[model samples]
Target: MTTAYLYVLHGRRGKIPESNLELLAGFIADEGQLGRIAFLEGDEQTLEDGIRDLQGRPGVDHLAIVPVLLYSATHIRWDIPERSAKVLDPSITVTVTEPLAGTAAVERYLERTLGAAVTAFPGRRVLLIAHGTPHFPEPFEELKELASRVGRTIGVEVVPTNHVGHPTIEETLADEHGPFIVERLFLTDGRLAAKMKARVQAIESGDVFLPTLEDDPVIINAIRERLAEAGV
Candidate 1:
């Protein structure tokens, strides 16, 4: 019997969103021969504990760590592997796949999310608000490129804005028209999510539409496809 373990890696937040985790579990059950489903938190000790638990499971043949992250940052590339090695047996075949970045599915998801806002208004400005990384600028740039592509494809004016790093909401909202839509590009509803909604609401001139993470089917499908590709 082939026993495959689907391990989802959490980020600095120390916990994965229940919705995202549910989506991942559903994908694994639909695709691979799942032996055991395990959730690993984002701490050093918790990750080790999760790996050890998996290693101790009987009849386990293959172990795969799928990170539910947006980019291939230091944590996904280095920290996850280093921590997993401490508990994994050397004989076991282990594979760590890339995070959800540069995938056509993800691009499609972003396009659809922004496309909806564009369709609402014929010639108005639409902004794709994303959680930006200060140290690494690749994700922000990638989002910007995606927004530009979507705008050109749909023949609408759209701009990608970041909240944490440069080109902030203030900068993006400057010189913009009334009735703006701030689409939150996130996988979970955490502190950042709340803060984003509040900031948009505080804008006096325009109306903001807050779409929940569950509303975007494209994102859900993209995550499913990413897991399927990893042989989950």
Candidate 2:
């Protein structure tokens, strides 16, 4: 049976930034493999439709779905599996890989990103902003540990905050004095990055906002590793 790969995302406003996902898909297709993008929310194409379309392809039977998410939130914990189960054909073999949050590649990416921020603005506290889930605390806690680990590795202090839960970005910024380096932990550059940038700008604390992790080679390598693990 012919195998195809699908990268699932929580697209913003029916759109996503031009990032490594596009590049990976193109490269996969060039290598004679199938790669497709699917979204769980927004007005963009849905995951179910994407699966159906891929299954309809001639001789395609195995589908490897990689959730292009940084954290194991509700999307990866429940939504994707539940939705994919509903739409996949009986004869199709499907495998869903783990999210990118806890992966070594991601940790390296965070460490590298935070390292650069610390170098650029020495003595400034680093604030890591993540889009957390309100229903569960595990994801946010994971982020906290992640930040702490990265901080220890880089010999800097990294404060973790969420846009959805306690110690919100606004509250953290308001509580802290002096300039800070704000790093948004998003999978791609989209509305969330824009919104966070705007928020930091409005604070006027001279907080330096790091650029979004778009087309980062580290991230692309992380995805490649996931695909390899899944035997894609």
The numbered model that scores best in TM-score is 2
List ranges where model 2 is wrong by over 4 Å: 13-21, 42-44, 201-204
Tens digit per residue, CA lDDT, model 2, 1-232: 6888788877766565456666667656766777688888866668898899998898998999988888887999899989899999999999898877777888898888889888877898888888887888888889989989999998988888887777677787787655778888876777778887777677756788777666666666777777778777
Report how far off residue 148 is in candidate 2 (Å).
Answer: 1.2
Kindly report which residue pairs in candidate 2 clash with one another.
Answer: none
Report lDDT per candidate.
Answer: 0.64, 0.80
Candidate 1 Cα misplacement greater than 4 A, ranges? 1-3, 7-16, 35-46, 59-61, 174-178, 210-212, 215-220, 227-232
Clashes of each: 0, 0
TM-score of each: 0.78, 0.88
For candidate 1, what is the lDDT?
Answer: 0.64
Q: Pairing residues by index, what is the TM-score of model 2?
A: 0.88
